[model samples]
Target: MWSAEDVARDSVRRQGDGLPLTAVGERVAEAAVREQEAAERALVGGTFSEYEAEPERVAGIWAAKHVEWRRVRDLMAQCSWSRYEPDRDVQGSEWARSRAERRQAVLSGHAADLVRRQDERDELRAELWLSAGPSRLIRVAADRADLRPVEVLAQLAERVVVGEDGRVSVPPFSPSR
Candidate 1:
């Protein structure tokens, strides 16, 4: 079982990001924002084509999912520990054995959930390298409260210069120039 201090530390580290809140999630979100900003700068400065920018946008989606996965993992660990520890002390009782069996089933389900989350995380990570240029890489779900991948790409698109040759580029200088 997790100690009170462990739980407390986790809560404080979360810094107001809500339920299943995790410190890792907060850090990932910050990093994603920084990367997104860098990608935007590159796009506006003609340093990055839309093809190059797609991964940066997909990164935000990856960050959000990463956080969610870690949260699920943390919860699963605590639940498994709590279930096992009490049963350990009362091992000889028939009631304890029955309860342990039920708990084991639940823990097995939670373990499966953890595996699924890990698979999702890995898929998102793979997307960073496999994305096809000029095509959207990820679909943002409505429930997500993290960085808006589509909006970020759309903002960059507004500054793109498309020529008659069908090539997309940025102006040599900002309109102010």
Candidate 2:
């Protein structure tokens, strides 16, 4: 798909390094692109192929899978404590006025508030897991995703025995029961 202009632009750059195309390099590059396209068609064309996946469909699948992984990361981010709240750490409740410092925007204030709430939520979730244990935690997370908890337990199951149906067999609460 290289245009004549693309060929010329690239060839000029390559030539600047003392490798100018005599009379054939541009043609060779163009022919290589064309040949590759032709091979793609032959490999997946009118002959023996039962189906072909469209690029857009493939891209959509990739995007959805990416979003699923991102959801996992975002869930984990709720627990992130790598840094203190930006303004609170820097200025406390009172504003630190400087000749050049602008007032905090409304949206930024809301985002900080949201992060604070999420930190509290994450703490509660961690406590819930510690009390109910891993099976319950995986079940809650998987239920949120609308997938069976077993799918998630499969991803994190360690001590508990997981059945095909996702039931986890934890031993009876020890003497503490």
Candidate 3:
């Protein structure tokens, strides 16, 4: 089983491994949707609990949520910097100081709006991470195979449980509280 913290660390590793953060997030979201649908199908057929017992499904759900959080977090960072770009460019131009002042005022208002958007994005990203769960059921349907080893490791930093004696146990799947 993979814990939320593990998933977050894996996302950072993936970001460092050269895959664009947004792309990784998108992929995870897509996979989550797919797995959710599969779980739903199993539920309809009355075999959902059995499916949920698979460790891979739990790992996948954790990974998907983590990646999504990272992606949105990164986007907020980009917005913060990009929003100031125009203002910087305008300031560096040869326009008269008076004209620059007027433009700067307008840009300042735009920057405020950008800040609000960033805040909203941050809230949504937090919600996504905090509310992370596999929709429908806890299982992966038969429509797809298990996640790749690299993908799993990228999303899960460590085993869910490591005892003082170094005994590791895979945690059972459970719905998010």
Best candidate, TM-score: 3
Q: What overall lDDT, based on C-alpha atoms, would model 1 receive against the true structure?
A: 0.45
Task: Give the per-residue lDDT of model 2 (tens digit) for 1-177.
Answer: 333333333332233232223222443454445445545655564532332644333333333333333322333345452322323222221222321133246457779999999998865232223446767766677777676765554444334677899997854321110
Error of 2 at 10 (Å): 43
Better of 1 and 2 by lDDT: 1
lDDT of 3 at 4: 40
lDDT, candidate 1, at 12: 28
Higher-ranked by TM-score: 1 or 3 = 3
- Clashes found in each candidate (C-alpha, N, C closer than 3 A): 0, 0, 0
User: By TM-score, highest first, what's the ranking?
Assistant: 3, 1, 2
lDDT of each: 0.45, 0.42, 0.46
Name the TM-score of candidate 2: 0.17
Q: Which candidate, 2 or 3, has the higher TM-score?
A: 3
Residue by residue across 87-138, what tens digits does model 1's lDDT show? 2323223343554576688899999999999999865222233265443432
TM-score of each: 0.20, 0.17, 0.26
